[model samples]
Target: MSATQTAPAAASPSPASAPVKNSRGRVILASLIGTTVEFYDFYAYATAAVLVFPVLFFPTGDPLTAQLASFGVFGAAMIARPLGAVVFGHFGDKHGRKATLVASLLTMGIATFIIGLLPTYAQIGWFAALALLILRLAQGFALGGEWSGAALVATENAPAGKRAWYGTFPQLGAPIGFIIANGLFLVINFSSPSREWFLEWGWRVPFLFSAVMVIIGLWVRLKLVESSAFEKASTKGAIRKVPIGTVFRHHWKELILGTFFMLATYVLFYLMTSYTLAWGIKPADVETAQAAADAAGTPFDAAAFFPGGGFAYPEFVTMQIIGVVFFGVFTMLSGPIADAIGRRRLLIWVTLAIIVFGLTFNVFLMSGGSPRFAGALAQAFLIFGFTLMGATFGPMGALLPELFPTNVRYTGSAVSYNVSSILGAAVAPLIALALWAWVGEPWLVGVYLSVMGVLTLIALIIGKETKDVDYEEAGFSSSAVL
Candidate 1:
């Protein structure tokens, strides 16, 4: 008999057999809150790199070079993420998700708090940057293990028929975290006086405040049980001795496919959040600057594009918070939609939408905005980018878990997800920046995302459909009789 033939039929646990409601809900809650804290810490660094780090930690003779250095440190965390995934995934698969989740959250919180305390280059010279780098690496390492545990928590406890919807609950963390990250900064920015005061201390408030959320996340996570999937898998002694090696041996193609399939999603994220902010702040843009400077407590030439003829970055940062709200609403709706349509299909359509809309949005961006058109167009494109992100990212909660057997689901999905992050998200903002510098135009960067979208579209179209398969029955061919 073939593997499918020998495998038991996919089954859902009944009320008597299913994970009890309180237990499952607690697990989902833990996953959601834990992910929110993790991503909150992660995005806070990303935001600082853009808004404050270039001036604070990496003071330099040239403003441009300082900006590059700030981004360099931001990219460092991405490079560390996959390595963290491998190390943490191994222990997670071998031991349990509960322990791994708690460890990662603690590590992230500590790293972020330390970042808030680091001295600036003015205060401590190069040592400040060194300290920041070390903390960023710690944050990356913790994040590597975070997603896998989140995925497992939601998937393991979900009702079989509603797994896709439940899985999306963990995925909601990205937007929620973004909202909290940007909202905190928005509050600080509004309250501060000059850029001097903001950089002097306001910048650290968000990082220090994370300790409160971390404590809350930890308490919630502690109440959850170890995943039922992990419990069952452990009984069979099926945990891999080394997750990375096992993934390459047994599921190399799927890993590669997932990496490509997720490429466009990450690319769009950088484009909408980081790249748009860059374009808005560059000296060439007059109006965006004027708006920003006014929002700041600074005076400028009213005749200048900005008050002074330079772009103000903080105003755009406020816009990003608004964008996060739109993303949150769209993401919430995408979960049930994915459950109805299937993961693979949703990914394909979204990838196509990104390609088509990405090109059009660039055209709209290049056409200098009129006062009446700017807000509507910008919000529309922001929602467009995030809605595409939502459609693909929402189903991922179910899709990644469904790709692996319960025996090693935690390890396998974590590795693949983080590996995808490295290839797709880790370098995305850097690459887009590099592309723009290389070609001297944003259109070239759009082409880069378009190409990635096409690649991911192909991957989704060619990949096997996974809607109905049970976790244990995943990755087997339908041709194999059960």
Candidate 2:
């Protein structure tokens, strides 16, 4: 019998059997917690890449170059993510979701913890930077499998018409993780007496604290049953022996569409988080500010040095926290709205909105008439960008999985998601920095953002609306050759 035509195995739960509300709730919780831990670990590194890694890991020269180098290391994880997706996607599709998730979690947790203990350039020279790069790769690798698995866990267990709502649970992790990571950094930043001391040791605390979050994630994920969809596929002997190859062979169209469909979302997020942090913390005319502070026998505080040029680090982080709150709120709202209208329809509208926002993004930054004005402008940029991000990103968990058949769902979704990261996220900060330095205009970056939004808009127009599709059906033909 053909794979799709095979009878359901006795070991598998019936696809038609209604999912219990309580069990579905558990799946959501498990998925949310797993993603939260993964992203917290991930974003912690990102924040440090800007605020600490440059000084700690590198032999400092120019601050901007060092910062760019740190961002390059940050991109290393994005570079490794697709490889992780291929490896873990195979296991997830062929073995099971829960097993793969647990393994990914362990890998990420261990790498993050090790990064905290790693020696800096002052202690170990180049070896310190090398170790940081290796650990960053490990973080990328683990996260490759994380998002797709968590998304599947939630969406697969969703009741009829609630997939979008369930999908948002995993999406919620992004804002929560951002808040937690930044909040901890803020606490440490304030409590410490000296910037030198904080840079020396206080930053490591967040990375080390990841151990606790990982333990919690593991405990929750361990309790999760494999999704009924995967179990059903397994029982019917429908699991692809090499899921990555199978997806590439059969689902190439969905893969391409899914990747581009996410371009704007990925670009907007990294731009707002990492790139914005870099821009905001930069001292306005570094030499002038440093000279004034030195003449006064005080250290140059970038936050106060250039009232019209750059933000105080602490003030900018606080604004970002506020923006993240808006991100979280809109993320929750997007789900129910998506459920009401349609994922594709909402995405098209949101992408269009992002294009408009991207074009105007630099106006606020340019209007730094006063410190207060600059801060408000920065907050507006973040709140508006994140609000649009929520609408764009919120539907992705449901949208990606729904695009492919269950047999290759994990591989397909993971590859698409990670590939988009490489395309949009991995190089965004680097590109933004280069644009700002070379062209000397922030609006150019806005134009770049708008271009990505246009790309996504085109992809959405070309792709099918999948919200109404029956996810339980093995949508592919049994006669299809692998």
Clashes of each: 7, 1
- Candidate 1 residues 271-328, lDDT tens each? 7766676655534344443344445433433232111112345656666667777677
Tens-digit lDDT track for model 2 on 1-482?
76655655645778678563338668877888878887788788888987767667754556566777889999989999999999999999889888999999899999999999998876777899999999999999999999999999999889899989899999999999998988999899889776666767889999999899889889888888777777778778888778888888878888889999999999999998887887777553455434433443333243332223366667788989999888899998998888889888899999999999989867867844777877777788889998998888889989988877888888889999999999999999899888877766588889899999999999999887787777765444221111
Q: Model 1 scores what on Cα lDDT?
A: 0.72
**Pairs that clash in candidate 1:** 5-481, 5-482, 289-311, 289-312, 290-306, 300-307, 301-307
Per-residue lDDT value at 383 in model 1: 69
Candidate 1 ranges beyond 4 A from true positions: 1-24, 282-314, 367-369, 472-482
Largest TM-score belongs to which candidate? 2
Candidate achieving the largest lDDT: 2
Candidate 2 positional error at 242, Å: 1.0
| Per-model lDDT | 0.72, 0.83
In order, what is each prediction's RMSD in angstroms?
7.8, 6.7
